[model samples]
Target: MRIRIGGEVHHGDAVDLRGVDADATAVRETLDLAADDPLATVSATPPALSVALAAAARERGHDHPNDAEIERLRAALATTEPPDSSDPAVDLATARRRAAEAGSDVARLRERVATLRGRLRERRGGDAEPGTSAGEAESLAEVESAFEAATRALTEAETERVAARQALSRATERARRARDASERERSRRDALANRRREARAALARELWDEFWTAFDAVAADAPATDHVGDDPTAFDGDPVAGHAAAVRLARRDDPVVVSAPLFDDEAAATVRDRLRAPVVLVSAP
Candidate 1:
């Protein structure tokens, strides 16, 4: 039979197929052998010879290649020879290389886990270690347990901080209330003292007015200018009472001799000696 394989032409010795049955299995085996041949070239571009090969395969009930067939074809194309089983040194070197790669992967994973743990601790404001008592966490369960404990401790600390703040606020309020009360009491006491002083001043003024009025009346009732002595205007008694008594005695129209206890005893004696009248000097109790 004459056939075109890739861009090359070939002539194969013809075989008699008069009674041969072309089945799906026979066609699949033939295709597999052709693909495995190093000289056989199958183009991946469109309108290529592989299209005619696939059409021939479909006609033989092979249809399209499945995943397993594709993988087998890839493996067959990737390797030109079988691995040497007699070379122990080569096998050992390959194994060591693979082991080194696996170790590197494990180390990278551990570094990633440590980074995540550090971030978690920072977020929680925790000072505790990330792992369990054994140093590195052996399993997910141990890590979970440590995280739960940290969460509980953080919650407790926050609760205590809130309570302390509340206590301080309450104490500050009490102090403020005490200060306000003390200030109000002091103001009330000062106001009461001021009122007492005003009352005493008013009383002193009223007494002075009464004493002056009594002295004027007694001087008016004197018979002669000589008989009338200089007025004893100072007194120790209630001025209102003294003036009333002096007025009644002066109304008698007789030679009046006024005698009263007065605070300015020297002035009273001078008036008494000048008028030759009876006058009394009384000391304040």
Candidate 2:
């Protein structure tokens, strides 16, 4: 709210450009305020009303998302990729089948070897049964070898099945976590968007109405503004005068610098009268 020009600091609510150059470094510095700044020194422009409302909203801790921010949030909510279970399911089935096949083969071969050994024992230390004893002995040796091989295969298959079970469990847990995460993210985004929208909408309604009433009350005593008596968003008047009034009125403590040209000869007097904030006027050379 304080203006420092030509190494002299002037403190006030309103200021005059007077003989000062419009492009002076101090003038530029005074006019630029942060979005959330309650105080502003700015040229009265047509969009000044919108700017004022936004600043007021920021001070109130309400977020007003711009188009770019809205689009970014939309994109974030659109993409979801979860862990896959189909491939793991197929692997589990394959492992189970291999384990069962190996077990059956081992069992059949063990039974055959047992039967052959029993037959050989019946003819032990005697002349071999020419038709059957020698053949049975050879068959027993082959069946034992096959049983050993089958047993090894069964052990390997059992290991694979156990691994498959673990894989399936991991995949399921991952999928559940993925689903929960996505849902939580989506809910957070939706709630954020809703709050911002509601806050801005409420701000616009209250601020616009307040602006209209204040502007009307000051009409008789203050310099004329080029407003068409409609919504500030649709305002087609001088950017500096009417909206600047709304901005200054938004808060009582903030100093707002105004250009001398926006008003008539009565500017300084009316500024002091209608606006409680003290102002000093200077013209741009």
Candidate 3:
């Protein structure tokens, strides 16, 4: 349902289909005028849009008429039953309305052309014409004189048009390359982010298992107060091996050990109170 229209255009020609949503009869009439009239610039009818318009007319209680029938209906729609225009004022008003519409259309077309020229200039860079610098208007005259000396120089209009096309092409190529590179970078960053997330999850699981095991082993041999000691002297019968085991358990996640120690028996009792397991120790040392 989204229709986006943009990109570099090498050609200046345009085909407007603004009133395409109207009924088939109206569309056929428009088409006939477009084909015969000097002002009509619509070159090709879009098949998809034509069909949709016909269907919409049918849904709105107007049957889709055949081409000949459509033409007849269009004539009826455009012309009055008793067409006898004698008043010059009415004719003048009609002419004015049409002139205003034509002026509006021309204004819109000119604006489009100006926009296209601006884009081409942006691609070329700098405000000076192709071969000249900002402060050197006299040099531009000299450049033109030199260009005239060449055996096969293009007409002024043709040269400007060729320059515009080249600028448009370069701009398009740059945009395409930029888009492709951005997509690649985004894909690479997403892959790296996913890898980091997975690594962190694995590291967290490893740390959780290590801490649980160390807490279990310490609780089995120590009083809560000794285990919680801020600076416990090594007891006569304390198991140095148990502390070593805890140290090995804590190493995997790069945990910094400070003066604080776990109140192992109290921690164990709380685990039992909560109906959780006596921490299962795994050998990762």
The prediction achieving the highest lDDT against the true structure is: 2
Q: How close is candidate 3 to the true structure, as a TM-score?
A: 0.25
Error of 3 at 86 (Å): 65
lDDT of 3: 0.34
> Which candidate gets the maximum TM-score versus the true structure?
2
Find the number of clashing residue pairs for candidate 1: 0
Q: What's the number of clashes in each of the models?
A: 0, 14, 0
Give candidate 2's TM-score.
Answer: 0.41
For model 2, what is the alpha-carbon lDDT of residue 260?
Answer: 35
Off by over 4 Å in 2: 11-17, 22-25, 28-39, 42-44, 57-198, 217-239, 267-269, 280-285
- What ranking emerges by TM-score with the best candidate at the front? 2, 1, 3
Which stretches in model 1 have alpha-carbon errors above 4 Å? 1-135, 138-149, 209-285
Residue 132, candidate 1: Cα error in Å is 14
lDDT of 3 by residue, 1-285 (tens): 111123312111112222223332333343343332211111112122112222222322343214344444445444523323344344445555555555555555555555555554453454355755555655444444544433122343345445555555555555565556556655655655554344333333333334334545534444432333212122222333233223333322111111112222233233222212222111111
RMSD per candidate (Å) reads 65.0, 11.3, 36.8
Q: Residue 173 in model 3: shift from native, Å?
A: 1.0
RMSD score of candidate 2 (Å): 11.3
Q: Model 2 misses residue 283 by how many Å?
A: 3.8
Higher TM-score: candidate 1 or 3?
1
